[model samples]
Every structure is written in structure tokens, then in C-alpha cells.
Target: MIISFIGKGGVGKTTITLNLGAALATYLSQRVLVIDGNTRAPNLSFLLELKEAVSLFDLITDPKNIVKANTEIDGLKVISSPIGSNAELDFEVLKSLLSFFNLSFNFILIDTPPSFTSETLTFMELSDYSILILNPEPLSVIEAYRALQIASRMNVKLLGIIVNKFRQDAVVSLEYIRRNFSLPILAVIPEDPMVQTYTLEQKPFSISNPSTPAGRALMELASYLTGRKIEVQLEKRGIIGTFFSLLKKLFT
Candidate 1:
């Protein structure tokens, strides 16, 4: 299945895309491919520390370069876009490529630019499912609502929303969002400082620090997607843990 991760910029779409892909591949042993659809400001390559790698643009120029562009990272196949390339993004070509990729990959996850541009729209329209990522801020939720409206208008199949960078102290609670939006809440990833450290170390927290709150949330999401159960040991955080437990009860 092809799933596109969409939201406003700086809301953690790339982070979720990479970590979720890692979780699916490492734990479920699924054949997953993550494509960097944010051609304008691509960061997946930088995070993976892929120097001078073959990119999606290269494959678009010549379809035969598919084997070369499919680079492996932490058991997941990645087709990252050039960091500063000025190549024109053709949505039609991308559509065809995704169709061809369906034959080989169990999951094709796309990380798109954080806007309602043609690139983002095309990716959403092409996807079999789309997940909206947003932070626990009022403005972010408002933006996500706008995105949901657009996705509905486009007749896109929305899987749900993944609330990234979640904080127990945030003014906007998960229950508030649940009451406001019609879409189901898929996951709520906590704000963990180790995420920055892992990114600096060129690793996904899902694989490098699976015990972290963010990592566990991502693994649960992967499990929800694949219907595969994996044991995850949770660490207690006293009041914070109690708060999230309440939220989980509300969600159920």
C-alpha cells in the first residue's frame, strides 16, 4: 500500500516517515520503500547521511536507474531526492513510478513538502492512504483541519492523524482534537530530546532507542498498520504516565 505523510512544515512529517518505515522493516520484516517527495527541500538524504546518492529525480530521468536509486538504510529501501537539485517535479511521472513500485514493495511511504502545493496534492491523490502529522499546538491543529478539508475535497482516503511532538502540558489536549475533528487519532508521539540526539548520530530512534516514548509510539503505529504484535515494555513517568493513560482511555 502507498501512504503519503502530509502536514505543514516543521511538524515532523520526515521524522515520522523515516522512523515508521524503520519500525515496519526491522520488526515486521516487511519490504518497505520510503521516497523523498519533498523535492524542493529534501532532508531525508541528509538525515541518512547519504552522500552523492542516486535520487528519485535520477530515476525519473531514466527509469532504468531504479536498481541504483533504491538504496538500503536500516533494512528499509529509500529513494531520497537530491538536497539542492532544481529538477522539475513531474507528478504524472511520479504516478507511473509509484504504480510500478507497487509490484515490488509492501509499503510505499512518501514524505512530501509541508504545503498544499501541486507536489503535495499530487502525492495525496496518488496515495492509497494518507496520514496527517501535526504538533500539539492550536495553530497546528487548525492547519491540520484545513488539510483535512482539502483531502476530503480531493476524495483522498485518509487513514487518520498522527499527533507528533506531543506534550502532556500542551494547551491543546488530544481529547480536544478528537472532539473537534472527525478523523480518528492514529498515534500521539511524545516530545523526546533523544530524537535530536539520534538524528545527529544518523540513526532512527525506532531502531537505536526503541525504549523511548516516541520510539514506542512509532512501533505501536507500525503494529496497528501491519496487524503484527510486538512486545513493548513501557517505563513509568508518574504523573505524565497517568495523564497519557487517561488519554488512552478517552481514545478507546
Candidate 2:
């Protein structure tokens, strides 16, 4: 399956792309290839702690360089864009690249720029499935709606929406989002400070802090994608734990 991740800037789209690839590869034993499409400010290389001499741009310029640009770590293969190389690639080249990648990996996950740029639109058009990332903020919701419209126009199969960075006092409810946009609320990831901490440490939260709220949520998402049920007890932090406890009590 080819699934592309999209959302507004600072909405954790790339984070979802990286961690989802990790979860699918690490936990499910699937060979996953993650392609970075964010050319202007690409960070997948930085997040993965990899320094590649060749990148997707090189591959685009010469398809035979595919072997050199591909990076593998712990079962996950990444195709990175050239860092500090802001040249916009031809959309046809990206489509051809994805077609080439699909032959070898079980899954091809793409990380796109915020809006419906030519590159992101091309990805949406060519992808088999799409996972839209949404944060619980007004502007984020608006951008997500625009993304959804673009996906709909491209006739892409939407896997579902992954609501990122949820908090107790969030302005909008999941129900509100669901009613506004008709898509399954696949997962609600809680806002956690560990995400920032892991970013600073150049580690993925799914690996460094898998028991945190966001980690557990992502694990559940991965399980859903792979059709395996694995049990995990998410460790709760002070006030958030108390809040969830109260909600559980009230619901029960």
C-alpha cells in the first residue's frame, strides 16, 4: 500500500510518517519504505539520524542511483530528499520513483509538504491510500479540510484521519470533526512533552517512549493497519492520567 501523510505545518505530519513506518516495520515485520517529499525544509534525514550522500533528487535525476539513495535502519528503508537542495522536482519523476519503490517494499509511506503543492497533489493522485493528520486547533482544522478536498479531487483512497496533539481543553471535539468531515477518526494522539524531548534527542517517540500517550496511540494505529491485536498498557502522566481516570469513572 502507498499511504501519504499530509497536514499543516507544525501539525506533526512528518512525525506520523516516520513513526508509522517504524511501527509497521518493527512490530509487524513488514518491509517499509518511507519517502520524503518535503523539499524546501526536509527533516526526515535529521530525524532518522542519517547522512546520505545521495538523495531522491539524485535518484530523480538518474533512476539508476536508487540503490545509493535508499537508507535502511532496523527494517525500515528511507528515501530522503537532498538537504539544502531546494530545487522543485518534476511531479512525473516522483510518480515514477514511487512506482519503482512499490515493487520491493510491502508499504511505501510518503511525507509531504503542508499544503496542496504540485508535489503533494501529485502524491495524492498517485497514492493508493492517504492518512490526513489533524491537530485540535481551528487553523489546523481548516487546512485539513482543504487537504481532504484535494484528496477527494484526486480520487485517492483515504485510510482515515489521525487526529494529532489532542488535549483536554481542546477547542473542537472529535465528534465535531467527524460530523464536519465524514471520515473515521482512526486515532486521537494526546499532546505530550516527550514528543518535543525526543525531537531534541534525535529519537523517535515510538521507540524512545512507546508507553507515552502519543506512543500508545500510534501503536494502536499500527496494529489496526497490520490487522494484529497487541496489548499495551499506556503509562499516564500526572494530571492527564487523573483526567482520564475521571472520564473512565464517569463513563463506567
Candidate 3:
């Protein structure tokens, strides 16, 4: 499945995509490929701790160069920004990367740059599933609507919106998101400081502190994606079965 995460900046789009890909990586033995489509500020590799992986920038700028894949994490491989320092984005390069020989990955997650840039709009057309990440804030809701408008025009399948930073007393906000988007809130991640702690440690929150409220919500999301009949946990992280063969290869 080609899932692209898009939304306004700082709304946790990258975080969700990173953990989502990570969660899937643990469950499936097939490779999970994550491309840092956020050209302005590519952080998917950083979030997933593949600081040394090849980046999207290079692939987009010069397709002739092979994108070196890194096996930093089990079942996960990454491409980073290849000289993506505010450079003019080449959408065609990205398209080739998505459709190239690497299309056999079990799940491919693309992290888009904030806003509806040409690159993002082009990716919208290429992705089979696009998820807009929204917070309880009004601006984020409007941004989600804008994203929906763009995705609709681009012939993209919007999977659903994920409500991040959910609070107990955010009924009005939730109702607004539910009413405006007219799509189920795919998942609701509660506000928690454990996320901050994980960031400080440069680890995905769902992996480092899988017992937090946020982590369980992520597992539910994984169960939905995988279509696996796994029980959803509320306070503890659900351990997706790992490939024993892959794990042995990982540590050996």
C-alpha cells in the first residue's frame, strides 16, 4: 500500500508516518520503504534514526545516481534528502522513485512537506492512500479541508484524518473535525509527555515507550492497516509479531 501523510507543518504528520511505518516494519517481513518527501525539511530518516541512509533529494535531483538503501532497522529501509536544501523539487524524479524497481515493498510511506506545494500535489496523484494529520486547532481543521480539496482534485484516495493531540475536553473540536471532514477520525492520539521523552532520545515514541496512551493508539492504527485480527490495547503497546528469521539476521 502506498500511504502518503500530508498536513500543515508541526501537526505531527511526520511523527505519525514514522511510527506507522515502524509499526508495520515490526509486523511484516517484507521491506517497509519510507521516503522523505518533505524536501524543505526532510526528517523521516531522523525520526526513524536512519541518519545515514540515502535521501530523496539525490534521487529527485539526479535519477542516474542509485539511491543507497540502508538497513538501519529490521524490515525497514529509508531514502533521505539528496541535497534537498530548499532546492527546486523535481516531481518526476519522485514519481520514478515510487514506481521504480523498489515498488515491491510491503508498505511504502511518503512524508510530504507541509502545505500543498507542487511536489505534494504530484505525490497526491501518485499515492493510493493519503492521510491528513490534524490537531484540535481550527487552523489545522481548515488545512485538512484544503488538503481534502487538493487530494480530491488530484484523484487521490484520502484514507482518513487522524486527530492528534487529543484532549479530554475537546468535544467541540472533535465535532468540528467529524462534521467538516465527513470522514471518521481514523485514530485519536492523546496528549502525552512520553512523546517528548522519545524525541529527546531520538527514538520513535511508539517503539521506545510502547506502554503510553499514544503508543496503543498507534497499534490500533497498525491493526487497521494490516487487517490482522489483533486486540487493540488502550494503555500498553501491542507487540506486533516479529519475523523470527529477520530478528536473528538483525542481531547476528
TM-scores of the models, in the order given = 0.88, 0.86, 0.83
Q: Stretches of candidate 2 above 4 Å error?
A: 51-53, 62-72, 231-252
User: Over the stretch 133-215, how does candidate 3's per-residue lDDT look in tens digits?
Assistant: 98888788778888888777777888888899899786447777777786678899998777765665457766555677887
- Candidate 1 lDDT over 83-200, as tens digits, reads 6667777778888988988888899999988899888999999999999998989889889999999999999999999999988999899999899888899999999887876686
Q: Where's the lowest-lDDT run of ten residues in candidate 3?
A: 237-246
Estimate the overall C-alpha local distance difference test score of candidate 3: 0.73
The CA lDDT at 146 in model 1 is 96
Clashing pairs in 3: 54-80, 55-80, 55-81, 56-80, 57-82, 58-82
Against the true structure, whose lDDT is highest? Answer: 1
User: How close to the true structure is residue 85 of candidate 3, measured as C-alpha lDDT?
Assistant: 73
* Whole-model Cα lDDT of every candidate shown, in order: 0.84, 0.80, 0.73
Model 3 TM-score, all chains together: 0.83
**C-alpha displacement of 222 in model 2, angstroms?**
0.9
Candidate order, TM-score descending: 1, 2, 3
| Candidate 1 weakest lDDT stretch, 10 residues | 234-243
Q: 2 or 3, which is superior by lDDT?
A: 2
